[model samples]
Target: MSIKYKFHDPGAIYFVSFAVVGWIDVFTRSVYSDILLESLTYCRKEKGLNLHAWVIMSNHVHLIVSSREGYLLSDIMRDLKKYSSFRIVKEIRESTIESRKEWMLYLFAKAGQQNSNNKNFQFWRQDNHPIELDPHLNMFEERIDYLHNNPVKAGWVTNASDYLYSSAIDYEGGKGLIEIDLLV
Candidate 1:
């Protein structure tokens, strides 16, 4: 892993992205995505995650985030991924309506078996690919725009703010599913 992608400055905000293993479209169902949303909410309330903006796509998530004082961004991200992975994998395993349950579980189990770090399954890819943002460099707006417009770019919605799984609504002066620490 390159040091460039690592979280070096705890106070500096960062743009991060993590995808499901194999880029599987697991989040096509709201039930699964809701698990992620709940986890993000929990992290925000309890883990000191300063979430500025975010989006949940079909198989991945993007965020502009940092840690509050006395918290480490890396630690928060690790716990987020670890908890979400376990919950999402368990949900898929136990879901009676998940048509692709067996296939998804098989893939996760295969990925886990191939990787020495996992014991049973690997739901999320290991790398967060974090990019630290310098607050003084006028990067927040650009990143937020890019993050919010992801669904629009994908043709899922005409306007970014219309996407239900993103913080674009908050940016548009509407409350979203989760709270956001707005960045100017």
Candidate 2:
């Protein structure tokens, strides 16, 4: 029932990043990313969320998003995080695809049990440091470029659009994994 931080200003553009707990590479596989996509899709359709840009890296997510009808961005992010954590954990624990990763997950799970009141592993970092996009402060373009070039910067792919989990392609030519609301 606590009010989210982004609720204070409904019309502000926010660039937010949420890292995985322990920065584990939970999203190196598409399982967790798929869950994130599903949750985002639901939020966008049901709650009138405006997604400006997004990038799902190995252990973190960068999003340039706003909302419609006074919807709170923080609440939407919280829902996405919660749902992805649940679905990904369940998937990881049962799937043979992630079975060989037992030790890493066990450690993550133990950390979660210790950190949270729940009995399962946690997925995302608790702190969501959303920087308000202010063109005056000169951070807006920096964040946008960072999100677009992250995969390329990481050497995962030569072109930003080559990363299948990012919105760079959507910006370039609409060949992205998901629909994007072009900011410009």
Candidate 3:
């Protein structure tokens, strides 16, 4: 995995994306999305993640993140993916109000079967697609814009800051759901 998604610079900010298996709309429900948010909060508080920007879409999440306090970015990514996958899959399985439970489980199960790494269900895809953001090239700002505008482009909201599941609100000078380290 390190060969594919290399985090060479320990202190450099990276724009990373990880998607659900089959691009399933798993986050249409607030429960699953909230689980992810909670896990992110845990990671930030306990795992030394320096989160600069983030957006959670229906099928994937975009993050501009780094590591601090001697933490490796790759290790943080691994733990985040592992924990979130387990919690989200468990929530989906146990949710009584989830109308598409059976179908969703089938899809996840099929994805797991295709991947030898997963035991039963594969919630998140293996690739994080981490792109190291170079401040000299202004790639950080560009990716932040793209990340915030994802909800707007998907027609979920007319304005990026109007979306609740993103750090756009933080960028706009309002407190967002998840506390983030502001990008200066």
Candidate 4:
């Protein structure tokens, strides 16, 4: 098998995006999204994930991240995805409020069966599509803008900063849900 995106530079920041299998809109519910947030928080605090910006859409997540001095961004991302997938799938299995619980679980199981890497469920697609950002070339502004404005483009909010599931608010000089290492 061939991989499209690779984490070549260990110290460089990357803009990475990953989606749910079949592009399912699993994050439409706050419970599922909250699980993702919790996982990200854990990574940031314990796994040396240096987050610059992030956004969680209905089916996917985009993050601008790097690793701390002794950590690898790729390793951090792998753990984040693994833990979040297990946690979210468990939530779906036990949730009393999820309207699409059966359907979502069935799809996840089917996807898992097809992928040899997973034994039961596959909540997230494998590729992060990590694109390293060049600090000297002013590439961050463009990626950050694109990441922040995703909710606006999706018609979820009129203003990007008004969206709660993103770092847009933090960039606007307001506090966001998770801590971010603001890009300069």
Candidate 5:
């Protein structure tokens, strides 16, 4: 666990990507995706997270985010990941409609077994791979476009704004599922 990609500059906006333990399609169901959305909402309202862009794919999520003044970006990310991982895994286990419950649990459990930090299951991977966004270099705009277009690139939707689980709608001047501070 190197500190190479860890959030160091609290004021710097970062583009981060975090995936499920085995790249499982855990977010195929709205139940799981909704949980993630709720977590993001909580992070924004209660955790001082300044979200500029975001997209929730089937097995992972991408975000361009920063912390408000007096808050640490790393702390916000740690809490968001920790809380969402626990809640999402719990939801999967308790979901009566989840057809792949056993399989998903097995995979998560196996991943947890390999990772010493987890008690029983590991939902998200340990690393966020945060890349600091440089607005002067136009990396900010580039990353935001990439984040919004993720679902479109994956063939989930023809237009990025049509993707319901992304902030593309916000960028398009439409209300999105979660409240976001638009970058573009």
Candidate 6:
């Protein structure tokens, strides 16, 4: 879908997702995932992204986050996608393990054409569908639980808190391995 709405507001809760080109399993490696983690770190520490919840799936990412420091969520997403897009393409080209690189790139090109007037590659979907969250306690808790349980529901892990890549542990009042800004 075309990005019709440019969400530049800081205090908005966004539940965003970006699929891999052709829904390819590009996040099968630790390196790409590390890049995502690094982006989140940069968001929290530098860009003022206050993450309430997030889950890294095989082909997509789900994040419920907002920024309080007047930084736009769209800008944060643009930087992350641009950086990860280049790295992922480079890795696919160089790594012998990436057998599906050609097919994936082809599909990305197709999607980009369908989605926009992009010429080369499109790593993530352009639209980041952000829903404004109510400050009520129950609604906040419910969404947080959903984010944490996503990996467990997908059968990737036995327990929600066991998934180190997610914010489940942090929501459960434990120390998360990836440094996250405490939900604001």
Return the TM-score for candidate 2, rounded to 2 decimals: 0.88
Candidate 2 lDDT trough over 10 residues, lowest sum: 1-10
Scored against the true structure, residue 53 in model 1 reaches a CA lDDT of 97
TM-score of 6: 0.85
TM-scores of all models? Answer: 0.96, 0.88, 0.95, 0.96, 0.96, 0.85
Report the lDDT of model 3 for residue 53.
94
* Inter-residue clash pairs, candidate 2: none
Steric clash count of candidate 1: 0
Clash-forming residue pairs, model 1: none
Judge candidate 2 against the unseen true structure and give its global Cα lDDT, from 0 to 1.
0.79
| Residue-by-residue lDDT tens digits, candidate 3, 1-184 | 2225589999899999999988999988888889999989998999989999999899999999999969998888889988999999898899898888999899999988888777798888887668999899989789999999999999999999999999998998899998999886
Ranking by lDDT: 4, 1, 3, 5, 2, 6
Tens digits of lDDT, candidate 5, 32-62: 8998889899999999999899999999999
State the lDDT of candidate 2 residue by residue for 27-64, as single tens digits: 88887788888888888898677888899999899998
Question: In candidate 4, what residue range of length 10 has the lowest lDDT sum?
Answer: 1-10
- Local distance difference test, each candidate: 0.90, 0.79, 0.90, 0.91, 0.88, 0.74
Give the higher-lDDT candidate: 3 or 6: 3
4 or 5, which is superior by TM-score? 4
lDDT of 5 at 103: 99
Put down candidate 1 lDDT per residue, 69-122, tens digits, no spaces.
999888898899889999999898889999999999999999999888778999
Give the distance in Å from residue 92's predicted Cα in candidate 5 to where it truly belongs.
1.0
**Candidate 5 CA-lDDT value:** 0.88
Report how far off residue 166 is in candidate 5 (Å).
Answer: 0.3
Q: Which residue pairs show collisions in model 6?
A: none
